[model samples]
Target: MNRIWIPMAAAMIALIGAAQASAHESLWIEAEHLDGVRGYCWPMGRPKMKTTAGHWGLSGPGWAAEWNMGGESGFLSIATGADDDKAVATKTLEIPTAGRYFVWVRYGDWREQTERFQIQIQQAGGQPWTARYGERAIVEEDNEMKLYWDWVFAWDRHEVELQKGPARLSLASTTKERSPRQVDVIVLTTDPSYRPRIKERPGNHAWEILQSYRDGIPDGLEPLAKNRPNFNLPSQWKVRTFRNKDFLYLWNVSHTKPEETWLGDKPDRVKVPYNIIDKETREEFEKTYGGRDDVPIFSDPRIVPTFHGVGAGIFTTDPKTGELLEAGKRFAAWLDADPNRNWAMMMNYHPGKPIGEKGIQAFRKYRDRFVGSISGESLGYFYPDAKAMQQATA
Candidate 1:
């Protein structure tokens, strides 16, 4: 939980007929899930990096939160840009009350903004939040970048009835504040799902899972570790799986509150919205936890986070006695999520100089002696996503 962010608008416009809109369908929620839902704020057709010196932001791509009917939900930004047209922009969400609800909107590619945009839910509100049945004002748009509507149930109770104390859900304004060009992206998906269970995670990961890495690792620690990748894509990659089809994820958020509200008018403040998952389905989550080999590859949290924090320490490297790579006795990285993106995370390790559960039981005895191949579920595994592997191996 660092600070919190969600700003960037320029242009977006696209809304026609709507026969079930499709951009390969969109939805994601990962940052260790299975309950304990936290960050959730959709609307990211890529859009980060405004001046990392000239372009470099929006790392991982995993946002859109609010499940379990808590509060706050609504998104949209953008108001400029137009090399030709496809630069309209939209933001709408209103469910003052109804009941069984769910919605998850996500967009991507930010650098001011510009894409086939248009999202609606035009008229309907007030009551307990009545607005279901084909969703009154329920408009949708995707343009073509993938990730448009991952889930939208709406059983109808009044539409989404809910009001007690300080409840919230918006989208339908008259301009109390509108500038970022004029409004490009914005959303409000009422708890698309709701689960809750949390445990792992202990240190590190306040943010930055691979920012600049200092141009080229001027020896930031041991040897390799240059970083400066992701937005470039290299240092190991692969691809396949129906060529992926579509996706436009974006991440680089923070929020656990930022001074309490307003979001400081601008200037790249904090950021939030972790969670990320999508790739058709992600091989049913590596056959439900890599089939389980006593399942101790750092407790199978995709090999112990390495990023995103919570419990760490399970080093290895004994190539037949090459020695000096045995450190265990510490672990943490469990998260709970709900809002239709169902979630839970993993990662643990430890031993002599560590703490807690003997450092995850000494990384489960060096992962049952010798790491064992390694698997924690990453979908097709092509890995490549440092910007689509730099536009598919450039």
Candidate 2:
């Protein structure tokens, strides 16, 4: 009875999952499928009669795959030498039936405002109609640095009437620039409600939360065992011999590539120091350090590297004595030697700690030291008052 019921339950679950997935499938057309043709070929400028021009091939690497639908890598680029010189790339797309369709062009704009083009579309028996399209200057410096191809959603949607069979879409550069405009892909859908897939920029809080979760470290906790400093020490210094149990162990703790060390040689034959910890010491270390069994712990008195600008290290001593050497002594000395040294600490506080007056003061101190943005959801607690929160957000 149990076996029979289980099979029925599993089949029902599979059917529900299939229904949910099928709901997202929609009718659409990809630009790469359209036939491409150019008046002139490459090298000798031979004329070709095909739909697509090999001369105006795919754009820069990774641009087509990222912007174009169906992960296509081909695009049509038409440039004109002089204002009178005509260079048009025509793409022929076959339609099932004559109807109204929504059109979208995946394009980028890095040219001057005056350097624009006209998109001409011709139905089966109809004459060509043109639409002027151009891009405006980006005000943000960071957004301007992105490749023009990365602006997938920077296009406007236009409605076009088609009469079934085949339609000719042409892109002709109206400017005199050497390379006027780039068209990654043209998407046409019968459903007027359809919207092109685009990447949305995350807000400040969302971006902060995303970055916080990326390093696999818990919120408000620093990655202690990952990415150690490259000290470039001799091979002999890689392994240290201790009098207790006569065990050879590695000096560094790594989440992956445990055999690698700052000493530059593989500790293939050496046993891990954490695995060889005595039962009593292991219990004590776990109690003091919160017994996180997920990551390997270094059981030696060594310097744990950090990404802090001051080159600080977390110095750990004997677990039984609970001794921790001042972690930032080396960093302090380095800063003292050069008073003008620009350095800041990458701090990770306890997640459970309340965001109070002390936390706000600490955040301000860190913000002044670090010349850039300090991101983390943990910092949100520093703004307890409503006005302070508003000011911080602003």
Candidate 3:
């Protein structure tokens, strides 16, 4: 009985040891850590020698650097000249007891340009298998200027099969000329669905709503068309309702830049000068009205028109029934009363045409009537200023 028990215990120990060995064989190779075969270097163009730990190598003619951003230790970036050159990084990893392994690559395209590259793996007694990667959807980076990098980990499961002992894993960018591709790291995992921990951008609800609108209309609404009038609004315009407390507001957020541009082309059309005021004029205006009874008004007309409306208006409605409330009627009446007031103000201070005393007074009055905080339930209209409305008609 003792002899039998000893043999059984030995067998269990051997199985546990094999499991540990298998786990140890998995690889996590950093691109910058690979052996630099021919021409890879650090940030200052310093030469990096080949080693078992890994190094970077570049062939042809280009520059490379170590970029540490988005919580990565240091990713290799071929900053420039890769368009006419090739960059490659290679490493030798040993597989203790390999069967099938999923491959995951961590990389980034700072420029949002789809960069293409290939991963070649040569097993002990097998031909090299090259898996191409790139043309991935551009992931929004916190910093889009390329001053900082936002790394994305894209993976292909069970894509690589390895044998026991040493295997040469390499990433080569030797195809068509283009911008340099960012390489962070490559991971091999027995778990097919394994994903490395990395920071991800927060989701925006407004974007989600916009995406939903693009995908399909909500229930009970008319099928959306680029040209459809609703509730006396012109074609290509509609009211979007929003509620706050007891009041519902009608908002028409439409694109009017094209129409505005066309209106500018007409000889008789009144063009509202936007961002035409030079810095010098703004400074003079501030100095002249530094502490006068009149409020100093210096704003980017282009932004102002866009912010207010091409025919943008907000009016109040009965929250429960969606019927126009008294406040809503009043708001509409105000819009109709002097439809040209807003646009006239915009055009008064056209570029090279300084704001006269009359223009200043008119702007003050316009501000008092149009711009105010909305509290509780209220009605409003985002109608285009009189000029835009006229242009639309013309």
Candidate 4:
């Protein structure tokens, strides 16, 4: 009876060990940790990489917050700038006791911009299998579109089968020259019910390494820390809402220098669906989109008229002469001459230099047209004499 009891107890211990091993079958592959093969970009170039402390609810050392603008930390960026450009990131995934592993990749799908990507897996002596994804409708919640990183399962084409060894896993872009798509991490799990939560899971070696790298930074090479946006403005001025009559802003339309090419012709720079037109280019623009009301420029709910912001030296003194540029005067006349040009034209300024008494007086003539200096949102901080400048505009 004692021998039988001892054997039963040993069997119970073996069963518990098997259960524990099966419970920990999931393996996390950090996207940034993967080896970049081609057309891959470092996180240092984008605010998402520089600002996010730790993505997916994971944070530790090396996770220094630069601007705290909110984005993923240690994420991989796949560039898509040219027709022939292709981005690929690969890593060897270790399978503990793999039979069939579900591959999950976390990525940002802001406005369905990052909808084209592929997840490929290859086991030893086996041909590679690709699970392709394509454009998906934007997921919306609470009357707003979602723009955060979410997980997608690689199960469209085939189930990923792996042996209990190393398997080559890759993420590749399938778009023809566009914005970069960011990938945060990948998870390979044998448990059918396992789904990644919002926070970081245990056993993230890449996260650990990032912390160590941050801890080892020398004295002055550290990145400059920046405070987040100040949302503490007055209640009425807190939110700037766009009205129906508001137009999309465009600058440098009045550059008289022939050497400075006009950016209005560039589709990338002038991203509106309608071709920009004024008194000079009206006939040319009307030839294409004049009769079509269904075109995006007319049909899109978010479309607005283009606001031409003409730059003049008086808004900020001329670099050499400290006098109002003749070109600025000409643009103001051009904008005023045509009764049809009432769609929001303004004077653009640099404001990096002090607007002397002369410049300030010149600005008073058309103060209503000036929309804070081209420094944009930092006008309060970057623009010298904020109160004086505001009073002049007011």
Candidate 5:
């Protein structure tokens, strides 16, 4: 059983507020939201830093103060050194005007070893400017935990210019010592005297909205973990009733034929579309086991299409002539032909070489027919093509 929690309404409100705010007042960017990460932490082979959401007991933010005080999502953390070390996270933002901006970083000062890191600012297409920001000492909080793990004024002595148009900001690991460092948010402001208040944290409003939803409808959108289907294959199903949509995902589609097909393109390379059982096979299986009390209805293999293998597989190609297959198009057309049905799909391109521009274009061509957008596992793996698709659709 699988479930996903998506706070769409609150997230949209936050985005609108940020977009309308004047850049000079102050700009807040959550560390977790920052992109262009280069690291080896996640098993997906990208975003070296680990992301934490909600709360975790025993140490860090919760051990000191209320965890929600930081932001909507928790934070991005990294422990540098050894084979798992070295990570840099960067984000590009549009600078409203050219001027000097004061930089402040909010981080968990739970350990001294992970206290500091290098910060850089660069105008798009220009060389990066580095600053030797001194080590920030923890400010003793007047609380029982006595943990002042929040924003610290960084690069106080230098003028970090905010170039007009797109500019990049980066936070990188500086030491080879393996110690956890948690970063909640990063702020850039034109006012040197500016200080961040807990109430002004990025996700406070979203958090309040989420609380309202929870309080108003206690069981409105609780996880359907136990109600999920088990088709004997790995899959992910996301339900967003507020938007009247369902996102179904399946990957690594393997087939029964081992000796006749191309299986060694990449280790454990799974093919696609082929993983979907034929209509006759599905009907026969259903006839045999459909309504039996021993088997759940959702467990039926034909409920929603799923890919069972993970490797380089042909989405729409013929092995004999390399001609494109029309089965995927036919399936998508069948789904879209019905106006009353609201369905979306998510597909993975792990090792991303299999799905290129053509695959992304096919998704964009059918975007309007679906209620929800396509999603990926890792930003590093599909962000380039995803960005292109988004731009084209926009």
Candidate 6:
């Protein structure tokens, strides 16, 4: 079993405390499993080599490949200038493991915003295959969408398996002059279909929205003239109702950045779907959701979204201190309202950051804390426990 499961499991015990659990087994995929995947990138680059098994870099012709897995950003990034005028270079290698992986590919269109990318992978020494993924329906690109270069900064995942060891991984590209257009980060896992879940939301109403984005919004909801509203206020936010279904999932919409850039609106800063539910709905949601134990609390206010709406249940800040106010009643009320719940846990701050300093405990509404689990979480901005976040803060 992937060791990542330990952290996730710990967080799970911390989240629902002891009753609920996520359907997914692992959080990421194994890099070794990605070998032999067929790939076709647009006009500028090709697959290369990795100095190490988990390390990937440009290998076809030049020494100017930008890699990011262990770089400052800890993401995959690439630089151009590897291909000479004669003919584009092509690089290929055998992947080590076999499992689902996330392939992040981007093209810089600064000079030429027009480019198409073809990426694929396959069993090493076997016919290559391109993993297909579902794109969100309503994509509103932001200013950053124009592209700076090929970035491996994306963590959006796809379902694939690397059963055949020594997989052959290749990235081939053709570009306009000296442009770099590919960078990638590979996360592996045992389950080919494992996808992470989001934090909060109201109902399945968000599902229709996500499905529409993945496929295309249903005709009924499509704007008359093709205008669609963007709601990222929460982050790459998504919403869903679950089995115990106590809380509505507010997941992040991963590809909401440029190509389909939003004329006006910050990607990280988005508006919540306030119109979806109202006060009555909250009461009903609590009634229907019953009670659930397991929502680990965080004392850090940053752990909680600062902005709150009528339907956007949020913690209140101390008018005098300016620091987030403590509020345990809100969560307690939330749990009390739900019939299936019983356990209470300590607050789960965003991994590190002091709990009482700014977490749910900062507010009177979330005072009654419960068991805490700050490790193995990917909620919000992929926070690691205090131990993990310590370096980031440093």
Which structure among the candidates has the greatest TM-score?
Answer: 4
Global CA lDDT of candidate 6, please? 0.34
Off by over 4 Å in 2: 1-55, 63-85, 111-115, 135-153, 178-180, 199-394
By lDDT: ranked, best first: 4, 3, 5, 2, 6, 1
Comparing candidate 3 with candidate 6, which one achieves the higher TM-score?
3
Q: What RMSD does model 4 have?
A: 18.6
**Model 1: what TM-score?**
0.18
- Stronger candidate by TM-score (3 vs 4): 4
Candidate lDDT (C-alpha), each: 0.26, 0.42, 0.46, 0.48, 0.46, 0.34
TM, every model: 0.18, 0.35, 0.35, 0.38, 0.35, 0.26
- By lDDT, the better pick of 1 and 4 is 4
Tens-digit lDDT track of model 3 for 269-337: 223222323568645654554433333222222122322221112232344655544433433344456
State residue 320's C-alpha deviation in candidate 1, in Å: 9.4
| Residue-level error in angstroms, candidate 6, position 294 | 49
**What does each candidate score in C-alpha RMSD?**
27.1, 23.2, 22.9, 18.6, 19.9, 23.0
True lDDT of residue 289, candidate 4: 50
Model 2 RMSD vs true structure: 23.2
Model 1 lDDT on a 0 to 1 scale: 0.26
lDDT tens digits by residue: candidate 6, 293-350 = 2212211111222222211123334546745433323433434554342222222223
Which wins on TM-score, candidate 4 or candidate 6? 4
Residues 1-394, model 1: lDDT tens digits:
1222222111112233222232111112221221221222223233322111111122222223212112122322222222212222222233344333333322222222222222223343444342312222122334222233332211111223232223333222121111111221222323433222221111122222344464554454564565554675564664541223222222211121212211222333211222125534433533443433342232322321222113322333244543323221111121112111111122322112223454455445434222122223221122334987788888
Winner by lDDT:
4
What TM-score does structure 6 among the candidates reach? 0.26
